[model samples]
Target: MPVFVKKVLAWGSLAFLIYFMAFRPEGAAQMFKAIGAALMMMAQGLGDFLTSLMT
Candidate 1:
């Protein structure tokens, strides 16, 4: 079903991320950390947006 497909895609994405982090970790480490920080910021922004919309 669609839910199974979504789970597969999510797991695939996670595997790719782990592979990238493991190999060529020098420059990639900083890049991945920066991306993780950006994602966290975006998540926080989304949460704030949703909270504001509710109130």
Candidate 2:
């Protein structure tokens, strides 16, 4: 809620990401791949639900 807290979180997250990417590029790639798979699955599930509602 506070601007200071938001800035801290943003910078902290950026730093962590930079560290992870620099130290473990393979792990970062796998993490992104897993996240993409999860998002795809969620989108497919939502589409199925909407189709079922229509029929």
Candidate 3:
């Protein structure tokens, strides 16, 4: 995909997610919880990988 198209799609998806999270908090709580867990996992994995590289 072209860079602009990709950026637009990404931003659109983010906007939708934020919209629901803001206005439909009860309905979107599970999804937000999952996103939070995934982000935390990603951070921990990246930290471990970087530590290994430095050692």
Per-candidate alpha-carbon RMSD to the true structure: 4.8, 0.8, 3.6
Q: Go through the candidates in order and give the clash count of each.
A: 0, 0, 0
State which candidate has the highest lDDT. 2
lDDT of 2 by residue, 1-55 (tens): 9999999999999999999999999999999999999999999999999999999
How do these models rank on lDDT, best leading? 2, 3, 1
How many residue-pair clashes does candidate 1 contain? 0
For residues 1-55, write the lDDT of model 1, one tens digit per residue: 6999999999999998888878868867889789999999999999999999999
Residue 29 of model 1, lDDT score: 83
Candidate 2 vs. true structure, TM-score: 0.91
Error of 2 at 18 (Å): 1.5
From the highest TM-score down, the ranking of the candidates is 2, 3, 1
Q: Candidate 1 — which residues are off by over 4 angstroms?
A: 1-24
lDDT per model vs. reference? 0.91, 0.99, 0.94
